[model samples]
Target: MRILVVGAGEVGSSIASSLSDAHEVVVVDVDPERVESLTYSEDVLAVTGDGTDLDVLREAEVEKADVVIASTDDDETNLATCATVDTVSEAFTIARVEDTNYLDTWREHHGAFGVDFMVCTDLLAAEAIVRVVGLPTARDVDPFAGGSIQMAEFEVPEDSPLAGETVAEADRFDELTFVAVIPEGADHASVPRGDTVIEGNARVVVVGRPVSVREFARALDPESAASEVEDVVIVGGSTTGKLTAEKLVERGVSVRIVEFDEDRARELAELLPSVTVYSHDATDPEFLSREHIKDADVVIATVGSDERSLLAALLAKREGAERTIAVVEQARYVDLFETVGVDVAVNPRRVTAEEITRFTRERRAENVAIIEPGGAEVVEVEVDEDSVLAGRTIQDVMADLPAGVVVGAITRDGQYVTPRGSTVVEAGDHVVAFVQADALEEVTSKL
Candidate 1:
């Protein structure tokens, strides 16, 4: 597929990098430095021009593109880019917007802005945060097979019992499958073997039924795991924070919003009747202590600025918050935030890029979860007669595919199917597989 990605920012570059190896990718940016940098960094062609301009689109050969993605930071710019692309090509257009109003309007009338699909960055980030909050000790979480199957990543704490155990020893859950183990400081994840050790500070990725995943979360840190999170404190009145609180409230969890702005706090109080909104500076340790933040199940910081969010999250953690989740605007700071004691750092751009990538692979993948930015992915596909797994047993299929491909789970007729060596994959079965970065293209082609 020939993909034209507009706005060579973090989200656009991420999408281009992920697809460049498998598809013809062209990236456009207004900054000459960014364009030149991307040209050298990735295999994709980068053009220096305004993406919303007709001349720029023509220069990028938009007519031959199979997909045109508008990922500029501004919602108006993305919508304009998509609308402009539609005038010259029949390529499927996707727009990435941060505003929910645009998303709601587009949903009411599909293709309203000449966009075939749209990804809302804030909403995706909020959903990602909520998913992590659902599972205790899960640094990241993605659902597949209509929520029946979950791919969860957990950091093995230095003092945890599972720290020195091998994958085989941690494979006690009946319905869970250990997928990958990313050692500390590693950029890529390796599909785990039975003998792979679960070292301290390493992150483990697993796929299984939600119940089993939840059980594994408890086992990861038994003393710290809670049956359910009862209270959550959000340290901002941003869109992502509001969405996160809304979802948590739906789950019957008590929520509190600490917004420094008095008017915004009042607005949030009106918007979320069930949630407690406090108009005070979240960074104030005295205010946090007064609000019982130490007793809260989780503290989320979505203060809009990376520095402030990091400060708020770390302070909350220091104040004895059970867990801290921060919304990181910069993708590069995700690892730093987690390394500094933030339980989870949700990158809105990364989440948006992953969502857009899922649609780009609509030919086979029903859903896609990027475990690590450009490292590994968990993809869900419906096996057809032409698929390699159609009538083959797990063992035979493994022998045929690349070494890093692991059939995590399968669902047929809306029922979970545990994948084993003897289990044969039938046509129409929804198969979820963990694919290392290098093997993703080949594994997807075969599956």
Candidate 2:
């Protein structure tokens, strides 16, 4: 597929980098610096001009593009870019917007603003935060097979019992499959074997039924229980924070919002009567202690600024908060925040990129979750008659596949299927497999 990505910002650059491996990608941006940076950093064509201009589109050969993505920071610019591209190209159009209003408008009319699909950044980020909060000890969570199957990533602390155990010793769940193990400071995730030892401060990815995944979460940290997570305190009343609180309220969890602006606090109180709203500086230790933020089950910092969010999250962690989740705009600081005691760091741009990149994947892929940036991915593919595993047992099919591919879970006719070496795959079975970056192309072609 030939993909044309507009606005070479973080989100657009990330999407281009991920797709350049499997497709011909072109990037358009107004800034010459960004265009040159993208040109040298990724294997894609970078055009320097305004994407909403006809001459620029012509220069980029927009008519020949198979897919056009508008990912500019400004919502109006992205919508106009999509509309402009639609006038000259028959390419499928996707627009990324931070405002939920545009998403709601597009949802009411499928092809509104000449866009076939729309990704709301704040909504995606909020959903990610809620997912992590729902599962104890889960750094990341993604649902597959229509939410019947889930892929969860967990960080093993140094004092955890599972830290030094081998994969064989930790294989106690009946419905879970260990997909990959990423050691501390590793650049990529590797397929785990029974004999592979899990080191402390490492991360593990597993796929299985939701119940089994929850059970595994308990195994990772027995002291943390999902049922015990009742109170949540949000530092900022940004859109992401508000949406997260709304979702948590739906789950019967008590929510509190601390906004620096009094008017915004009043507005939030009116919007969410069930939530407790306070107008004060979240950075003040006295204010935090007075509000009893230390007793909350979770403290989330989404204060719009990276430095502020980091400080707020760290302060919450220091104040005896059970867990802290910070919204990081810079992807590079995710590990730094986590290392400094933040329980989880959610990058909105990264989440939006993952959501959009899945649509450009192979036709058989129903859903995709990137385990690491430019690393391993967990993909859900429906097996057909032409698939390598259509009628063969997993063990027999393993001979034809590379070593990095691990079948994580399968679902047939909406029923969960536990994958085993002896399990024979059916034609219509939906298989979720973990594929390392080196084997992605070959594995996707076969599956």
Candidate 3:
């Protein structure tokens, strides 16, 4: 497949880097330095030109592209690029925008601005934060199989019942699969074997039905298993924070938003009548104490600056907040946020990249999640009659699959199956599998 990406910024570069591994990728940008840097670092063709111009699109051979991704920082530029590409070819056009207004308009009117798909960073980040709020102990949570199946990552606490148990011994949930485990202080994660002992503080990834996952989470930490989120405090009035507050309010959860900027705070207060908006700096300990941050069931920091968000989250934790979630823009700071006590870290750039990469995957895959950033992925694919995966038992399939890959779960005719060796995959079944980054291509080909 041939893909043309417009923009060489963080999101664009990330999409190109990931797509280049499995497909022919061409990246366009006005900045020669960024284009040159990508050219030197990735296996993609870097074109230094204005992506919105027809001549530039022709130069990149957009007519031959299977997909054209417009990801410029400017929403107008991205829309224009997609429009131009649509005029010249029948390629699928994906446009990235930070403004919810543009996204809402595009979504209501399909093909508006010549965009087949629209990815909103703010909405994606907000949704990620909301998922964390729903499952407080999960470092990350993603839904697949049309919400019937879920993939979640949790840190094994020192006192967890399964802390010292091996994978085979800790298999208590009939509907859940323990896919992989990342040992404490380890740089890499692996598929857990029967004898693999889960150590304290290790990250455990599991996939199963939503109800089963909730039960498994409760078993992992009985004290923090209340899945109902009552109080949520957002420490920023940015678009991400506002969106999150809106979602929580719709779900009937009590929400309070704290903003440093008086004007923005006033706007949010007027827009969100159900939410409590405070015009105060979250970085100040006095303001936080006055707001009773310690009573918040979940505290989310989505400030513009990563440092500010991190600091606010730390303060929330210090104030005895049950869970803390921070929006960190820099990918490198994600681990640091967790290390410093943040329960979850949401990166908009990475979220956008993951969405775009899912669109680039084969049609059989209904959903794709970048579980461990660039290291691991979990894909939900439909077993087609023509595919090699159909009409085979899980044991038979595993024998031919590459290492570091596991069939996590399957859904057939609306019924969830925690795959076992004897479980046979039928055509039209949705199969979710965990694949290591290096084995993704091989596994996808077989599926």
Using lDDT as the measure, which candidate wins?
2
- TM-score-wise, the better of 1 and 3 is 1
TM per candidate: 0.98, 0.98, 0.97
Error of 3 at 376 (Å): 1.3
Model 3 pairs in collision: none
Candidate 2 stretches with Cα past 4 Å from truth are: none
| Clashing residue pair totals per candidate (backbone < 3 A) | 0, 0, 0
Once fitted onto the true fold, the runs of candidate 1 whose alpha carbons sit more than 4 angstroms away are none
C-alpha root-mean-square deviation, each candidate: 1.1, 1.1, 1.3
For model 3, residues 1-447, the per-residue Cα lDDT tens digits are 999999999899988977788889999999999999999999999899999999989999999999999998899999999988988999999999999999989978988999999999999999988877887688889999889999999999999988999999988888999998999888767999999999999999999988888898898898888557899999999999999999898888999999999999999999999999999989899888888999999999999899999999999999889889999988889989988889888999888988888888865777888766346888999999976778989888888888989899999999887799998899999999999888988888879
How large an RMSD does model 1 have? 1.1
